[model samples]
Target: MIACGLLLLCFSRKQYVGKVLVALGFILLVISSYEGISGRILRSLESQYSPINLSQVMAPGGSATIQDSVKWIVVLTSGIAGDATLPYQLQVSHHSRVRLIEGIRLHRMLPGSKIILTGGTGFDGSPEATTMSRVAEELGVSRADMVLEVESRDTKDHPLY
Candidate 1:
């Protein structure tokens, strides 16, 4: 829409219509992408919850947290590049990297916990979970402590797999 408006404004005789379209398109784009607006909407729709404090939750011996039954930390992957030329760390999406890192952190703190990395061979033909696993290993997590769910296509499929 923005591109159409710009083209009409530059090359067509309907300059006034083009200007109106350009203004509307810009306004819509800004409104859709603005974090403050989205945050306000989310704040209205979601319930507030207490944030977790590791210091208070984890046992003093670094063995188990207060929730001794907790055994798995699931980390869902967003996506990854299929390009073989790129290193595993470079192929993982930034969001996936952050999530994997946090999962690894939790795994370390919880001792017996395993990190379940989830994703599938998406459009790029690269299993997102495999890429996450390689990066997790590079970050010092043992392969034995990580389970890769590499058949899920998206967030909805992650739990199913």
Candidate 2:
């Protein structure tokens, strides 16, 4: 939408404004197409978290080493494609899929841990948590081990409920 608005302004009768809009639109197009911009942004956010060793966590002696204080494994939902025709896994966004995989892995490693899938229905009216739970079930995480927090529409609501 921004791109279209800028492009329209670029073709306007005001020559000076059009020229400036053209330049701004070109810059916006370049930034939008450049994957590195988004990569760096995501990297900056991910860098805040300490890395986890799944191998050590899944080892025979590893279960005894985990902190007892850590109980629930929370997997925050991203957007879903909302395509019923697609497979459950394919319906989830890339980021959400990765998060679900990691959550499932953690749930398997931690014997008594339960996974909390958090997300509400998006604009499509299909609950994100439902999609996530379907995929998790397909991946072998039992329903008994999962908790669906389907009321959270966004990040702000996730922590609250």
lDDT tens string, model 1, 128-150? 89889999999999989989899
RMSD of each: 4.8, 3.7
Q: Residue 99 in candidate 1 has what lDDT?
A: 87
Give the alpha carbon lDDT tens digit for every residue of 63-155 in model 2. Answer: 636546457999999899967888888889999999999898778777888999999997679899999999999999999999999999899
Q: After the best TM-score superposition of candidate 2, give how far the Cα of residue 94 lies from its true spot, in angstroms.
A: 2.4
**Local distance difference test, candidate 1:** 0.85
The TM-score leader among the candidates is 2
Q: lDDT of each structure?
A: 0.85, 0.84
Error of 1 at 77 (Å): 0.4
Model 2 ranges off by over 4 Å = 1-22, 53-60
Kindly report which residue pairs in candidate 1 clash with one another. Answer: none
